[model samples]
Target: TPTTIPYVYAAEEDRCAPRHDVLIPSRMRFTGSTSFSVNVFNISLAGFACDALLQIHRGTRCWLTLPGLGALEASVVHHNNEGLGCAFENMLNPAVLDRYVAHYPVPETEELEA
Candidate 1:
């Protein structure tokens, strides 16, 4: 049997705006021209977290082009083997972010059926 560990929230978690878990697909390109596809795991007015194959160094500036949302400048804040965390250079408009989050894309099959 495998042991399960409990989860813990960070002390400063409440200081930041609430992060909403979403699966927004996007492309990220670094200043050096390195680019990769990333799935935005969560987003907030301040920043977002994404999972990507490449290893990005902290403080490296990048731009994310979200599907519905336009490109936004951001900086790498932290990273791990699985992905990197980033902070937007400018905070996103809450209304715009919320609208994008609420809009769900229709499946290809559903589109064909309709």
Candidate 2:
């Protein structure tokens, strides 16, 4: 098993799962409803953050569809100007996460020495 680094959250609600920042495109839909395009910004074995301007209630059941994968069941955790944050009903596999990170990596600042 790959080791995961824990990220500290707000004092009130803390999250420990390792979070990988990416820009993977996806589709989202409320339970048994229609789906729309979304972009996943950050993902983990536990949850993911997207650019979906969800005006739904927190804890609303929803499904997230990623390319090469079927609908993944999750629920609305929160939403802000940054977009919607959701938690998966079942923890995602680490290997699966590795694939996404391999494709879309967190942007890094580059310094050139000339």
Best by TM-score: 2
Candidate 1, poorest ten consecutive residues by summed lDDT: 6-15
How well does candidate 1 match the true structure, expressed as C-alpha RMSD?
A: 9.1
Residue-by-residue lDDT tens digits, candidate 2, 10-112: 2105564788778788999997678999999889888899988758787788999988999998878788988988888777888998999899765564112
Tens digit per residue, CA lDDT, model 1, 1-114:
977431112212442667776677889999878767988877777787888756767678899988866789988877787577777877789897897567634345745665
Model 2 lowest lDDT segment of ten: 4-13
Highest-scoring model, lDDT = 2
**Model 2 C-alpha lDDT versus the unseen true structure:** 0.79
By TM-score, how accurate is candidate 2?
0.79
Kindly report the root-mean-square deviation of model 2 from the true structure over all alpha carbons: 7.5
